[model samples]
Target: MKSDHSIPGTEEAPELSYRILSDTSSSAPVIVFFTSAVVWLLVGTVFGLIASFKFNFPDWLGNIPALTFGRVRPAHLNSVIYGWASLGIAGLYVWLTARLCQTEVHWRRLLYISAILWNAGVLYGVVSILGGHSQGIEWLEFPKGAQTLIAMASVLLSLSILRTFYGRRVKHIYVSLWYILASVIWFPILYVIANLPFYSGVTQAAVNWWYAHNILTVWVTPAGLAAAYYFIPKVIGRPIHSYYLSLLGFWSFALFYNWNGIHHLIGGPLPTWLISVSIVASVLMFIPVITVAINHHLTMVGHFGKLRYSPTLRFVVFGAMCYTAVSFQGSIQALRSFNEITHFTHYTVGHAHLGLYAFFTMSIFGAIYYIMPRLTKWEWPYPVLIKFHFWLVALGITLYVISMTVGGFIQGLYMNDPSRPFMDSVQVTKPYLMARSIAGVVILIGHLFFIYLFYLMIKRKGVKRLTPPWYEKAEEYAR
Candidate 1:
């Protein structure tokens, strides 16, 4: 990666002590992890579109058992969450670990084996759910056998990361490493505890939401934030505004987020005190959200112009903004008053997408744009495709989220009104549901384009441009 201290009169140069992109042993697993993730992304997109279409055209699949909305929806969710985001996060973990530790991966073969086992577990889980073997939990729908495989894979990966960290060449660990390492620790514990089959009835429901919510907060959100922390500074050619602030954000998140997941049970049959505690925890999460927002946005204070020249900057900043928006919105949604309107409505669906797609998934996309080129030693085949992928998915998700939000609001209001027939809400929401279908199509197109571009880069078929697109000095180009 190139550095630019374009800001004049900077007495000390930004730190370039980190090593990156030269560790083929580490890069190999990243490639496999990411490539498998893209395949799952495409599969998840198709399943998501089918689910959207079923909202409007229920007979489109003629009542096939596997194609039913109930089954396909969970299949889509599991596929994207486990198959796509999990794999992408694994890839990010590998790269971040190697770079920060300043060492080649110690157990490269184990990472390779873990990647394969991880994908296999996710595949089996998705298939089992569609095959009616689901464990009937929301996020832990995967059967115990598949869950065991995933747990084992996580254990192996986590051990590899810890070993790398122990051998780190740098004395002072960056804040991003804190997040990356924390996620590795948090996920396996959450996974094993949540997937244990001992609980039933109300307890099971509580455990289910606990796993689902924390999977997002502890696992997915941390990976995305880690990437934003690294890439934002790397692309902007600056250190974070405050390392102390970043540490504060990480500790606050670790402390509050574990208690926050229970808020998803706001109106359910859970104890009032538990619910109140969760509400407070959710609200406390804002402290960290604000800290992160300030750290990232403040670091980019004068480098907003770099977005024009850096694809990674654009994707990451967009994701960082979404993280702030989604976290704030989530805190509000956890409130009893706000949950009264949004709970059990499509509004919740839209909110989930806001977190998963706009925040976490987009962050991974940005990291890929930055990491893949270095790993493959080839630039993206077409800068235009990069632009296309960005705009298409951006527009698609915006439309998708907005339509569901407006439709859900209308649905909730109608549901609350005594005089309105229940079907009235459905009638009014029909248009928005259709709009979601359209948006899904647009997003699918973007996925296809991204997959093609990824294939080209992996094949190393692009022109030999060492720098990112639009990254050239006028003098050098003229020569």
Candidate 2:
């Protein structure tokens, strides 16, 4: 391909220029999000691999408290959740809100501050955990200083998105904006209440769990689901299945997801009413989950053929289905008998991967697939590498999730027997532990390949020269 302008090798295309203009103003934030996410993924996976190995050989590495499983596991989780997913979502929120509201980010410096504060908070928290300092709660393990920084960062991010909605040029304020805007409001409340120092013991525990769960549904999920609501319809050239149903999905989730976190402690020391309320909320989440599933399925129903041809569509569809699967699994696992068999095992770890990786990360992956080429004014340097990136990680995470799920079930079931010794159950899960470590390596390689792909795009010298760059499909080109 030769550029239309007098420039070195690049595609010649007009539409690519507009895509650049629409996207590049926000490119710095996007790049910051992705660069930080990749680094976090690497950091988290190293910790995750160590955590998995610790399962099989508890003292293989060291007996030091700083390197112990307790510390490393939280480091792993916070890096993945707060560092990767939350940063990615913040970036997506900025991009989506700008598109919907037809407004450039107001006070773009705030976005830079938000991104910097967020990265600093995550880095501080991960380092502190490895230094054997943590709050020792599930999700709020970050030290108080780090937690406060993160909470403030969330305020900046929330305002960045909400201001757009307050001044949207788009008449109808699409369902995606509604979902994301509501999520911004939901997050500050969730974080502030969770960080309150007054609560302790089981009350503290309940609040912690509530914040943890909502972090997924209210923060990471809405960003992901909103992206789905936007991209799926746009990619397929159709409206969402029903506007009213979209509203229903957003409201149902807003109402129900807030209280669903305590079901994790179904039989714990917490009040029966709190756990019971959480259970009811968890179950009611099905209304929103199923409704969104129906809307996506119906919107995508006649467009199935496109999935075979479009890489972005394929990944997004897989994520959409995984959303359905993970949601149903969460609801089922919330039951007392089910949690009795699955809680606190590798089963929970598996479920987390299914939702976080298979569902949420897949959507992020799809969004990148669609967004990157547009920004760079070039297609993927190598299609084979692109396809390889998807399948390898997809297969790797599937093995990771399934092996852990089965191993966890065996561990949980054996542990409940009381007669079976704890060490014996650990012996049975050794193979699964090894499998998970190996899968971590697989995903690590997949991420490295993606980084290379991105690097190639960024290094090309004649980006603007490619006025009308290659388009994967007519619909994408038309945009």
Which of the numbered candidates is closest to the native, going by highest TM-score?
1
Instruction: Give the lDDT of residue 95 in candidate 2.
Output: 76
Q: Candidate 2, 301: how far from true, in Å? A: 1.6
Compared with the true structure, all predictions reach lDDT values of: 0.85, 0.80
Model 1, range 110-170, lDDT digits (tens) per residue?
7888888899998999899889888777888888888988999988889888888886766
Which digits, one per residue and each the tens of the lDDT, describe model 2 over residues 11-111? 45433433333365556676677767767777887788888888778777776877888889999999999998888788778777776765445556777
> lDDT of candidate 1 vs native?
0.85
Candidate 1 clashing pairs? Answer: none
Model 2 misplaced stretches (Cα beyond 4 Å): 1-22, 63-65, 461-479
Q: How close is every model to the real structure, measured as TM-score?
A: 0.93, 0.90
lDDT of 2: 0.80
